[model samples]
Target: MRYLPLTDSDRGDMLATIGVSDIDDLFVDVPAEARLSGPIEGLPTHASEMAVEKHMRRLSKKNLAAADAAFFCGAGAYRHHVPATVDHIIQRGEFLTAYTPYQPEIAQGTLQMLFEFQSQVAKLYGCAVANASMYDGSTACWEAVAMAGRVTKKKRVVLSGALHPHYAEVVKTMAKFTEDEIAGGLPSMQGSPDDAGLIERIDENTSCVVVQYPDILGRISDLTEIADAAHKKGALLIVVNTEPVALGAIKAPGEMGADIVVGEGQSIGVGLQFGGPYLGLFAVRDPKHVRQMPGRLCGETVDAEGKRGFVLTLSTREQHIRREKATSNICTNSGLCALAFSVHMTLLGEKGLRTLAAENHRLACLAADKLDAIPGVRVLNDAFFNEFTVVLERDARELVRDLAEDDILAGVSLGRLFPHEEALSGGLLVAVTETASEEDIDALCSAISENMA
Candidate 1:
């Protein structure tokens, strides 16, 4: 029997108690133009669960999933192999059912996991400390910029043209409400930010200089020069990583003296569940800037008994206590995902992770070699980790669509992300993971060759 927790009368009574005539009044703040006039046009108003499931399955069958095709798409999110054990452990009733550990006494297990996760992230990025987790890489990036502004007490932020467009936009949106200035929304470098151009843009007014590792087109740069340039101008250097796996092979941003490091941790212990429920990894050098870092941090401390224990420390600086004076308003942490990431990292260990990253790079290089052999395709970047961009002879959007028709889930077309950049509109970014087999790469290469011919 179905349980009706709230009947129509109950809803009406609640609405009346709140001085609202109907439930729709609650949504009055939403613009009338934005509101749906009726139920979705083609969908049925109601259906039995079984019927809905069948219909959904039918609809799902019309599209190709990563497993169903030679998938190469990875602009930010990646398709990686998640071990069966990760799901099994995370689904434990104790861990899955628990909420935020506001009380450290009862939340020892949860808090400990976060502490470990933070430690792992700090080590991975070669930073002093890391928070539990943020919403995703993009938001973490925004928070990093805000933190830089606070620490430097400067208004201007220099964003590399090589930064991801979506990430750059998010930072810009946040800057709008702040007193900070953002300079250089330059075009993406496809491989790395134009270091020379970024260096040129830095000035005394700049608080931080931001650049991406293996940037939008998957090009890696030794930020020592850029970091030195920013530091010379009394500006902090913020490094972004859309793909965390690259860190295994490439130099850590912190090693090059990045004041702050932020990245998407989806490649590790996270699945590309259609772009979301991903983890954000943020780390910073040990300094006063720690107070400006967003999100909650779990610290290890001894209890009255002198045994090992975990507790929430430095919370007085958060939004609830500090109000407008708080460093950030981010109240929630990506707990479960963070736990999953911790578990995955623990299982992989340092050696396993590095091997996995090497495999991904190897496979990607192989795929790039094959694709570049195609008559109309030319690999753009000479240096990349697991992803690279290819310039197509024809429109990249059309090529992607044509390849998809053959059950090949090709790379992301540059036109899809940057519509106005004529030079890049015909480029497509392709990625390869350890999950992609040699056969998959060969199939994708064959599809592109046939299409181009």
Candidate 2:
């Protein structure tokens, strides 16, 4: 009752003020079948706090955690070894409880950390400027699309077939409200990315060409050519990096001529907590486009005392600006997660990050070679960073489920990612990070062999 403070009369009054007949009228845009008519079938309608906690703990145990298995699951979110120090630093009272730095004076500490984080992201992306952070990789992706549309003044978006399906979906979902035309199809089951295909699709009306580096299937492509092609057509190149660690070993998208570089920062400091609160890294290759970028921007400044200080250099979010004029409507950022990422990045300096990247690729190659040797599996990528695709003789979705039941956390299945596409039914994506040991790889290979047998 305390939480549900609004009375029926109050709700009626509020609804009338909004000129809606009923609460249901507010969700008119949602399809009828998608709306729930009653309580969830298996979940209890209400329960005591202790009872709920106990039930949740029991349910949570059913989840095979990444650390508990010969983990290989990565399709955007990665399970990197987050140093205990990262968690320790972020858990400090000041960093953990700090909210958005609305007032720059008292929130200098928060602003400073964000400024450092932005610097790390910009350097990592090879971008001229980067925002503080965004909701996640997916939303940052959509924001990049929206920003491209604003900068290029076009409606058509050419997405790479190799772009993460989830990221593409986010762009498409947001495009519905803006009426932006999305053009792309499922990725071809090939060794390389469809660079030529994506380039061919770019036209005068194209606002941006979105491509994921070391794309969904873990195949790396040179973004320079695509960037040049998009620029020739007056379209911007928005490169999405789902795995930031790869940048340590490969070229940054911005360095490759991408106009905007955005990605998930989960691999750095943030661990895969099932799915999210992941960090979103957003940046622009040119400082001129900074105003058009979404989320907050922390800038270095000198206070009245001539002391170095960090301030909210630019806050273009809807909360800080007029709704129609704001670059994005994102209310707040993944502040804590960003801090974690920053801490992790700081711990893994330039040399350390490169070493980590190398280790990831080393393990991935080992796993790929081992898996390819299996009777019914074949590695798909000729060049991959730390993740690769394998085509199996059997449906990968079934294999994954079977392996999962045995407490072996197999990789993501293309069948699960693209449920309706039968062409991808037998493709499995296996990710290998530094956390995965030689024995873990052996265990994974052995399990797959047994299951496929």
Candidate 3:
């Protein structure tokens, strides 16, 4: 029999105590049109654990995972070799089951890991500080915009059209409730924006100008000039990156004078996992804006014995204490993923990450060169990190589908994301991670060459 914790009489009594005549009265705020009339189609009421597991396993076997194909698909999420050690360590009972440490004295280990993660993020981005972790790259972008607005006390934000379409949509969704102005400039598959046009949209009311690093099209940009322009108008420059691996080869956003830097840390340790459970890396310049930043931050401090200890520091912005007045309503962080990121980064260290990044660039350049040699295909950018776009003679979506049928996970189609842009409909955004080899690149090149011919 199904468990019903509260009986009908109990519910009615509770409703009457609250001055509601019936249980339906509690849902008065919900509109009738929006309410579901019946159970969802094709959904079972319940199932045995063993039966459910078997069904789920059968369903999961149908996916074309990176390991099953010659993978090259990276728009934001990437497939890279994750050390078995990372999984082993993160799965440890102490680290795996640990929740947010409310009591600082008892949760030193968790707090220290978070502290280290924050320090590593700050160093990588060349920013003053970093919070623990946020939902993912897209939500972190939204938080960065909100923080910029809080810090600058302004309402308008300008976004580069070269920004990832998903990231832009997240920012736009948040702006709707905040009643802030959002300006999205011209879209380009090259990933570099028409900075001059974006600059023209900035005004006194603008709080921040947001752009991506090695943006959606895989073009790296020097934001120093854009930062200067934003500062001239008393606005901040927020730089977003979907590929943190590029930081090892390209200049850090902070070096380019970006006021805030946010990116996905998935490439470092986290697997693609279809979509996520990925880590969002957020960092900012040292100033009073720390209080305005969202998420938890662990700071180094002293214990009763005067030895160094770590604790959840500067948490006034979270949900538990600040309530409605909090800077952000984001309560929990991506703890396990952040731990995985920290562990993998610790294993790679500085020089290893740089070498890995260089290898990625080398492979991507080789792929681009080989593909460009094909008839009816053209490489669009001279400057890129690990990814680049190619102009194709046919629809990129159809080409990708054809490539997939051959057991090759091809690149993303620009047209799939921006349907209205006729020019981008035939462009493909190809990515190459360290996991890709010479053989893989050749296979992709050969497939495209044969298809085009």
Candidate 4:
């Protein structure tokens, strides 16, 4: 069926009114080199629904599905079994079909859930306040850096080597567009969380120091020293948690004095979905800086009848209010994903989360002991949560590729992310989640041993 609504007569009348002869006139300002001379090549002009489905199915067969293989893939995204109740709650007509809570009167339920989401995130990070949501963890990290710049009136931000490479790239990209500066490069390939070098880099010009809790490699460390160091120079301390489940057992970043905490909340009530539609968790320590936080904030108050009600309390995006005074260019929240997260967290109270976190750590321990027992492999992390790095006897990238051929999807390779670092070339990142059963762990171990042998 034709998708374009405008007919030949309607197009002519519209173009004539705009003083343009044809549709090509609209591209007058665009560079000729940038414009396509004709219809794009390769793709079909038109295909029946059945034909398109067949084509897509053929393409999909070439790629391995995570669930089918003995999967252990978690760099930022993780594989967790979301409860049926969480999905059921989110799929309801009111929640699933809802968009942003623009009209508070009719959107009270959405606003309330968002309010609860903010509260849950704030508690999880040990921060005072949290935004409704951001695009994802990486964007949230960039926003924290920007907010720190505003608070400190400085452009230089210090980043710990332990931060995720993708998150670092996002911060660098955002800095490129503005006057802000980003320091540091790919962190320790071994997944070491020791960041003494980062602490020394901070000075009066530093706006904030970004570090990760249980970092990219899942190594947990004390942030007290770094927080004190940043505070000495009047720099803010920003903590990034790519795996929020780790927070259930570890000390919250706010408890250790983080000025801002940002992370991915995809581990709870959300699937990998290949990559995203993940939740972004953003929280801050000071109420004074609430106005500077990105995205929307839901608030709870009593109405004229003294009944509790919810409202879109703080919206700092340029789209919501004044363009120049806006705190962020990102205006919308991840409504459905945030709802999924809040509902899951609500179901797992403080006790349930702690117990779940303990189980994850227990599984990781079992995997680490067995994997390290391999003749040529050594676990890199001494203190970790659910994931850790291992130094193998051979190139990890090659080993993982070989293992995949054996119908076993091994862990991510740290060396692949930093091709220039030879030290990391033999380093592989193994993630153990609740979904990874004992048999699955044994399969991964045997696969690695057989391939390496």
Q: What is the lDDT of every predicted structure here?
A: 0.86, 0.90, 0.88, 0.87
Question: For model 2, how does the per-residue alpha-carbon lDDT over 92-138 read when each residue is reduced to its tens digit?
Answer: 99878777787878899898898899999999999899988998999
Candidate with top lDDT is 2
Q: How do the residues 1-101 of candidate 3 rate in per-residue lDDT, one tens digit apiece?
A: 14458877888888889997966677878898876667787887777778889999999989877887888888899888989999999999898987788
lDDT of 4 by residue, 24-139 (tens): 89998888889998879987687778898999999998888877888887888888878899999999999888777778788898989898899999999999999888888989
lDDT of 1 by residue, 142-209 (tens): 99998887788898988987788889889989898985677756465354457887899899999999
What are the TM-scores, per candidate, against the unseen true structure?
0.88, 0.88, 0.89, 0.88
Positional deviation of residue 387's Cα in model 3 after best superposition, in angstroms: 0.4
Please give the clash total of every predicted structure, in order: 6, 0, 0, 0
Candidate 4's displacement at residue 393, Å, is: 1.6
